[model samples]
Target: MARRGTLALGRHLARRRLLQLGVLTAAAASLTTEAWSSTSTTAAPRFSEYPFSLGVASGDPAPDGMVLWTRLAPEPLAEDGLGGMPNRPVPVQFEVAEDDNFRRVVRRGTVVARPELAHSVHVELHGLRPGREYFYRFRVGRVESPVGRTRTLPPTGAPVGMLTLAFASCQRWSEGFYTAYRHMAEEDVDLVFHLGDYIYEDPINPTSNARQQTVPDYFQVEAITLPRYRTQYALYKMDPDLQAAHAAHPWVVTIDDHDVDDSWAADVPKENSPTPTREEWLARRAAAFQAFYEHQPVRLVSKPSGPDMQLYRRFAYGDLAEFSVLDTRQFRSDQACGDGRVIGCEDRLDPTRTMLGEEQERWLLDGLARSRAQWNVLAQQVFFCQRDFEEGPEQRFGMDEWSGYEPARARVIEGFRRTSNPVVLTGDVHVHAAAEVKSDFNDPTSETLAVEFATTSISSGGDGADVTPATLIRLKENPHLKFENQQRGYAVCTVTRRSWRTDFKILPYVVTPGAPISVRASYVTEAGRPGLQEA
Candidate 1:
């Protein structure tokens, strides 16, 4: 009866998660300001080092408020991944003020940072005004965290004349410095979208690191255990530039292949040495997901329940735009044709293959149909459009992304018709590109269904050249692909009622500490139009 009751409870939770589409409205995320019962207020505990080493962040913003995140990490690189915190819950205080100086305090609260969650705090707030900027910080005893800036979305269906945002992905710490993020921190954007590969799971070589920084021996092995994953996140989060970017804007994030493993699909792990059994893989996945949640600014709704976590959700920014952030990795079928670049593979065309599971696909289409926003955006990982690798009649495509799931790609393209203007923002290709989503890739003149702006990496491929020989060939092969550049950078978009303009921001070098950023190219899609044009 206990097992049956647990099964029933799991079914109930699944139903609840399925019903939650636009989580901003569906999830009751607000946390009470009352002190947590577990928190002790007798005396403030002291640490030998600063507790806010990992820094503060806010994300998943709504009209009323956003989730404020901070982890107490005095000894950030502790092997146990506990951040040197004692095995108990510590009382943490939070303050939301209208100004950075805390002169106009709006909301205040006390929450407990539990050792189970690596002494992390996610303060979900509400009752604040819409379409306004707010400053927030965490306090542990007399030590206060750095002031982080965040903003709430405008009211639902409210008239928003303009919205500016930046999207970035694929920052491998050992490869290069976070110079792009340092520049991104200065951008006057309202939001930031991190389309995954946030942390590379592979082992980092201390001697061969591009940044010439000292890496601990713990990172010499792949992050498989809970503590290893936590330490990996700490290493990435320890970057001041990354912290600055997080502090500057409210980020909406989703993971890709590197967040877990290379080209892992559904319950399947990638082919490699010392392959683990299915059960072991799930445990590793749970650890990775848990560590991801503890470090990110995502809400409680995103907390992982074992190997599964509810990550795919929608967010609306007034009547101007709506974003449907996707989780392509968690629910996708195993890659077809052996999961690599392949030609003449009929398995890719199998109608049963799915990029997003049937449920998420349904949710996406339904959301598109019901959306009243002027611009509907699919902020997701992986390339959405087709790309033929070799410049010849015999075409080969990467099997890991949408190109491998042809039927599923077609269905999503068909769903684009439900909205007025459809735009796809993609990552993980490590090359900046602007492509028109054609109804049929075989024919170059096929009607444009949507436009895709794929941003380059933050620092994944170090010191990328401008327009490599392969890039030129790819652009020539795929005419639908307008522009392609092998550079480390991000894409910034300015959305208005009339048009949405994207600036491909590029950095010359990331191996070095400071590199100047510039716009490589700019594309604009006018309202009611679905193709890209020079801005």
Candidate 2:
């Protein structure tokens, strides 16, 4: 009779556990359905799958540490709309090694992936030696993440020899494969810089075949909610090439307009539209910002809170390079017109109007002046060229860019001139271009202050646009512009004590998968000679 009772109790406990699993599965199913419809191809696959949809990444490396990130979502979409992951914290272990073999282990730790934060984990490792390369990977239970290689910035005041850095932006996943990232991964770069537009907020509309489409829109056509934002990021993070690139090196990231919305100016609600209120927009922005942080390998300083994330920061690579990353979307005045057209829009040209805000601008200028590094790299978004629309006196089109904010642009140029060691690295405009930055674009003989290299999009709008002629016309009008290529790819920059060489790689096409990539052009800026020259 005692043995019979023991067996009965064991059966009862088994039944209870089965009931719990049933409840959890039901809850996940409900959430998935509510979050997204199965009709959309972009809708995440059902939960309980292999190789988690969103890949893993690491970013924002300091002298002794870097941040590792990944999300846990077995079911991205369910009826209840909660992303299908159990609402429980899961333990994740991180291991870093000097070699890929995991033989010489250097750093190891464990962190909890809390479901309240979407089951994402961000482990910031510290106390490691400086200027060393390390391979790292994360694990939860029996599942292991892809192995990634990252390096810490060299110790301050250390005399560094040479550094290779690549910067690119504007990756619309559906538009094309991540050929740029594929190429970037193959390059032996020490660091990668993403200047923004990491993802587009707009849904893929069939009417506009201008950009490629990997998956259909999972959110509503008009606006995005928290779940929608999270799902979008999850979809983007699934790209293998992008994952490979992230696994290759630490990325320094800053957001551009499309990360929130197209042509979004500071604190300005959508023009002539009856949509969500300012508070609603703030909530949406907050959600988008949080999702971005959760997905990228950024540090804790950039954590999101209701549209408030301190994104502008600096990264120094010993005495070789100092990167001043900026935030241009948060504190600027509204665009002159809703369309980002209309130059000298009184509000745009206001001396008080700023792209980096007053505090950030001061910080940047101070950093530039005090920087002891051989190269001062300004990692920013948007074009720095005076991209005026007309070549001659016939007509001048006013578009949103550095040209729209003459006074603010002038201030940045003056700052570069004052420091005399600045190199402005920018993205956006979805086209590749390089220029000899001058204090004045209207004056051909104006003093050249520094140099600017603007990388094109990863896949946004495919390769060359039909406006190539107009682009060439504008280029011819501005003598400061050294070269321009309307292509899809990235710029690989090699910096040495004597010179900086930029190789602009162009992908054959973006609409089709597996597009071939080639070196479209190359430019070099020698020390003491600040302007760009054909390489």
Candidate 3:
């Protein structure tokens, strides 16, 4: 059940006054009218006030357990504002049941939501039966969260019957509603993977969305301060559909460029203009990461320290599937500029350039070599296909993707070939695509290493400004490319022991609020066959 209410500012002010008198704290004097203005504006609902403002969610499902999360906000924005709510810790109880009614409760436990953690609660449940479905919900005071369904992974080496998962990315708040998330919520999936650009870099200009406000610094623009970032995440989390999806299944998420800054590399700034100094940039990065952790259903292992967080990790669904989630942004050479086109930038082709960094690369390769799962799913951001913009030489576009780092791309492909994996799940081109990853695309007879399935954005922009028929012509010049659709929506993958099918779900239009969704295309790759075919 969803909680509803309004917070009166006068009541909060009175409470603050009493607390100040009782403690005789001089700091309480700083809680002036101006400080409370934002909180008092209209009694805006916050995660703490609603207890599920960021919505109920679960993630990182293992064979025996999954992580459940929610923030308890009894008063989202107190008199001091900042959405900090009460300073005291609150007790939150989570319930897991075999049925939606929750009458047959199988698991129940209490976890403390502390102020130090912004009143956020993360309860990791373990020792559950394998390959079983369960429904869960959190409760605090009189409030009950939306019921979410989650499942544990099957036993290792077990011949699992089937598995279904959805992949999506690039959800610009200003573009439109997350109809794709709504569709996914209604889906009976085992898991969900958000492959980055969960939030856009640019601020939501008023023109983009009638409800948006114009702000400066588009990429690092919207979420400058901690409060702003929290508000932004809260705004996105308020989407009922996205909430429903989070409630429906355990999600695996990884951040890409937009989450921090657009096309940001290891220590390099996006705009190249000398505005915020390096120290200021680092501080901003730290703030962004803290906000990200507060909003997402990630483990404490992903907690931010200053401006860095260890985000690359793996999750297994028994022998049926194993996901190698990657972090492409935190450790990569700066984007090549100066050559006019986004891709022709000379530094991109440098062999020393890396996307996953050396340590993570070795970890990935080793994991692939050691895994015995039937499907070795490389759940990651950006396309793994060699995206070249030329019929021959002297033609190219942006080098931010795998196309920019040829050596790294080749190493990944060669690793796949050596390991003989089944498929690679990808997102972040803001377009639907399918490709046959080969060890050597220049050699038509080269062995296909693994199949690549890339989903379009949830709602970014229509085909983007750069993608055109001319661009497609240039893209086709690369032999490994198989299919492409510059559209919006998500990719749903249905996996069996011998084959994996993909349904590329596309929305009518991202610009249109509440657009209808449809299955625009479908493809499949059979076991041992490392390329996609129309389903």
Candidate 4:
């Protein structure tokens, strides 16, 4: 391991050497070009190469509007996060159409692409009809971006037939090919929810056993600054399959620990780490949030203010379902007992310990009680249900998950009981899981109040197997866990007035490309039921 680490460090230094030359060249050219850009008479940059390399995306769907996003990057891997744009703002025209051919154009407008935000545009489109699909595209003079498809959520307090939504999380670029997203692009889902770990902060090491070094010297060092964070998003977004997924469906997203720093809970970071002070960490967090908003289709209302961003919000899909997306980081309490899996830890059982924080917890509970939809889905990152890793005399639990916070979990479970049909959609575990939310997890006879469906990773853990040793052990120990699988894929949810069904979509291999997709299992919950029942 030491030898591999040294070799990786050597490669990174070589990459930095190459980037220095490019940076110097860019710096020399920018001195002249940027000065021209400072004047009001400045025009667009001279682009001999295609600038729409990052592609276009639409997300944060509402009843009448959605957020459209894009960035111009003629040179993607330029070391600088400027995306090869001028210093001044550029005019970008966007249009939304009822049809793919734009014969029935509905809305058209122009927005400025500012250099302050890496020349990215987030056009929050409004005044459109609900429960309808729309095609949108961007243009800059003669150059045109690829057309993207998006849809608004169904009308509230209305009886909708059904909703087909796809959700997944944890897509590490080095793990495997994003062939799962390639398949998801072809799926007929109305919406997609990405529950964080959007990008990993660790340096890429090819000799690592977990995943192959797919893109080496690609921002190889850990991301701490704004430029590094922005560049990371650019690198990940370069995948055609990911771009296809974004173009295909509107997405609702929230970050996990990996988005900023790994295993970082609330204000406190992991024990024995290199982050010097809280101020520095907040700066790192601020950089991460700015880059996230700049690239994603998230709503403008949730924009970051320094170190914080209001990501936890609610969206209704008519009377069929309502999604309450939560942010597990930021205001959350630090993981009890100094993080990681622990057996018999007293800190984890503290009543004051919280996973959703006080404010978000209140908001979520109130939203669940007030929702008119038949299904109230708590969409967020990390596992919500309790899971004991070991069997018999000793009980081991992960502090990173809800299992560590007993009081918080109990309150959330009680809140679900107050709703019509509550369901928790989770990620960050890197494996598929279906479980029953017990009022009292220790008591076998305790009431099952709600249900949870933990979605698997996209390509984070490489080509995962259908049945792994960890899955078998966990299932044997925990009876409430109905199903689980270690596979590289996403989850397809079909919600209706009668029932909420989840299809565990699995791709056995994502090491190369074009792995055959299949449904590993199907589970359902009746309109008023809370526990899992095989469909």
Candidate 2, superposed: residue stretches over 4 Å from native: 1-47, 77-82, 205-217, 220-223, 272-276, 343-347, 394-399, 465-467
**RMSD (CA, Å), each prediction:** 10.6, 12.7, 10.7, 10.4
TM-score of 1: 0.92
* Candidate 4 segments exceeding 4 Å error: 1-42, 206-218
- Candidate 2, residue 173: the lDDT equals 68
lDDT (Cα) of model 4: 0.81
Clashing pairs in 3: 48-73, 48-74, 49-73, 148-247, 201-218, 201-219, 202-218, 217-221, 343-397
Q: What is the lDDT of candidate 1?
A: 0.87
**What's the best-to-worst order under TM-score?**
1, 4, 2, 3
Name the best candidate (by TM-score): 1
Comparing 3 and 4 by TM-score, which wins?
A: 4
The number of the candidate with the highest lDDT is 1
Q: Per-model C-alpha lDDT, please? A: 0.87, 0.73, 0.71, 0.81
For candidate 1, write residues 138-255 as lDDT tens digits. 7777566776878899999999878889999999999889989878877778899999999999898867799888888878999888998899999999887888788778999999
Candidate 3 wrongly placed segments (more than 4 Å): 1-49, 73-81, 206-221, 273-275, 338-346, 390-393, 462-471
On residues 1-535, what C-alpha lDDT tens digit does candidate 3 reach at each position? 0211112243233223322331123122222222111222122223334455566777877778888888754444332223556567677767887765566778887777776667777778888888777777666554556556677788767777578889889888877667778667666567899999887645665344733534333324456556656666666766666776777677999998788777777677676523257777777778778878877888889989989998999987767787899998888876666312463566776899898899999999898888888889888887787776655665565577787777888888777755645588888777788888887766767888788899888878853432468558745687677777777889888888888999988877655457777887899888877777898
Per-prediction TM-score: 0.92, 0.87, 0.84, 0.90
Q: 1-535, model 4: which lDDT tens digit per residue?
A: 4864574464344323322322112222222221111223235666655667787788988889999998977776567788778788888777787766566889887788898988889999889999887877766654567667788887777788778889999999878888898788777778999999989877766355243544546566788888888888888888778877787778898999999888997767666545758887888888889989888888888788888899999989888888899998888788888678999889887999888899999999999888888889999888987788886768999988988888888888888877988899999999988998888877757888888999899988888788877788888878789999998899999887888899999997987888889999999988876789988
C-alpha RMSD in Å of predicted model 3 compared with the true structure = 10.7
